[model samples]
Target chain A: MEIPYTISTRPDTGLWNAKIGIWLFLASEVMLFGGLFSAYIFLRIDAAPGTWPHGLLNVPVGTMNTAILIMSSVTVVLAWAALKMRRYRAYWWYMLVTILCGVIFLTVKLAYEWPQKFEHFGAYIKPEALWKYEKYLGNQRRAEKGLEPRIEITGHLHSENAKEYEVALDPVNAEPDSPAMDRPHFFPLPVTDKIATIEKEDVERATMFLPTHSAYFASYFTITGLHGLHVLGGVLVFTYMWLPVSKKLYQRNPEHLANRVEVSGLFWHFVDLIWIFVFPLFYLL
Target chain B: MSLKAFHIVFIIFSTLLALGTGAWCVWVDLVEGAPIYLAGAIASFAAAIVLIVYGVWFYRKMKRLRIIT
Candidate 1:
């Protein structure tokens, strides 16, 4: 089930060399992300529902980045089309615009989004924070035990052959202010406060994965982190191509620069494509 | 449109489909914070399938015209 390879020795021109190289590069990138995503799927299944820590992300900000990347893809295609039309001036302007979009995307992610993550990471990794979390949980459990009022009943818990029942209390004998249902807001609600407080023991159990949360957070960071790196690399590539050196190269063989842009654009589009997969799996699921 | 232009349009449309759907996924997850219908996932998967089909179709068309090897 493989596509047959064809060779072309056409003056190192046409789309042959650059197209093949980009396709191969994309294939390797597929394996890199594929492995990470597969790990995410397995961990997701292994972990219980609502326990994967999916609530840590800021959705609105991520959505904006998505729009920016899509728009950049449009600009890149326009730039490539300008080249096909042999309109060098239009091609340069569009390419510069596309590169600018990439810069904005990376700046937003690193300067804004990444710092928050670092702050959260600092809180999670601190031994003091873990100690505080434990103390809070202990207090909640103690509160639960203390809060429940003791009551003396004429009829008590009765069991026969593994069957158990509590005798119905007479209204006259019953305590008017029973505290059986008193719930204390203890254990410092799951960092996000998105979900309700679970049992003290469950909180401790979940805390084992605390330092970094779950595989979901791991994948979230790894995928986006790698994508960010790609964006940076792309900016550098475009910068070099837009520089005087690239202009000199283009003056000699203009098609070389065009081919270079085509390859870079392909990689940029692939980065956008991976985000398509990452957004859903991380933010939605 | 010529084949080249058609190819460009297909790629852009498919990419937009992927991005819009991907953003929707992030929005839903942020709002709901749990899995539901996953409309964004559905959209991206559909876009990926279409992109692949279009890629193959474009490649074949180019080959037939001897524009590409």
Candidate 2:
């Protein structure tokens, strides 16, 4: 049975069936993202001063991904326009580029950005020993480059008896299982000729700024992860449309093919729209 | 109203709302020196501009094809 109004507009709605359907779906998508965005605003406003993490995300990398998505949006629209003009080959090329852009965006997010966040460890230190730890880190940097350690602890270093000890941190390592695998042992700080071990007890808090780390991260992951899923969906749909099945439809009824591309393009643009908000909210702010 | 007219109007209104909100966020970021507001501002503003350009182009193309009067 053929579906009516697939190619032509209905009298009441003044839009084709698929067009109205996509608009309705996009309306719901707006509400979904709107709620998450509201949560982000509340979390940011309520966060304590100086507690929220900043300079955590790499701005240049985020900007690159933003550009990729924006370009994909244009290509998707052009793909639809190509189909409208009955240019099948041009449509295929534009859709291919759109899918490739989505692939690259996801690749950068999972391979680079997400892993970088997991590798960074934050340690909270006791108030009294903060200055000592700072001095030790400064001297450690100099000593690593073959300079003499300027600062020395002269007294009977109150080894294990002291309650207030400074938080010492380690730089992010390339090892896959590091920090996590070595959690039970002391946190190894880079000191000259000696492995300075910071026991877990002395450190007030130790954690990576993962989604579980704070409310800021919780909202960040939720919003962006959902947006990523939307991109993945577009990639799958466009891939299928570029295949032979859609070619068959193109030969039989080109208008049907064009309509499908238009619908998909609408969804694709909506995805790009969401990312426009997501990029700046997570990366810049 | 015609579908084309409705769509064009909707796009224009949405773009304006996005730009207004984005500008306000940027202003807040400048005053407060907060990262979140700045990020939101930039993204919203970019989205608005892209949609505006695309909407205008789509409208012109449709008119040329006699898809909308």
Best by TM-score: 2
User: What is the per-residue lDDT of model 1 for residues A248-284, given as tens digits with 9 covering 90 to 100?
Assistant: 8667766666667777877877787777677656754
Single out the weakest 10-residue window by summed lDDT for candidate 1 chain A.
A180-189
Model 1: DockQ against the native?
A: 0.11
Clashes of each: 0, 3
lDDT string, candidate 2, A20-89, tens digits: 8888898999999999999898888897654565445665577678778867877776787688778999
DockQ of each: 0.11, 0.08
Task: Give model 2's share of reference contacts.
Answer: 0.00
lDDT of 1 at A127: 28
Candidate 1 lDDT, tens digit per residue, B1-69? Answer: 222444455476556656566566556556545454265556566765666676577566555755434
Clashing pairs in 1: none
Tens digits of per-residue lDDT for model 2, B1-69: 333454465566557656865776677667656687678788879878888888889789877976547
Off by over 4 Å in 2: A126-197, B1-69
Q: Give TM-scores of chain A for all candidates.
A: 0.65, 0.77
Tell me how candidate 2 scores on lDDT.
Answer: 0.68
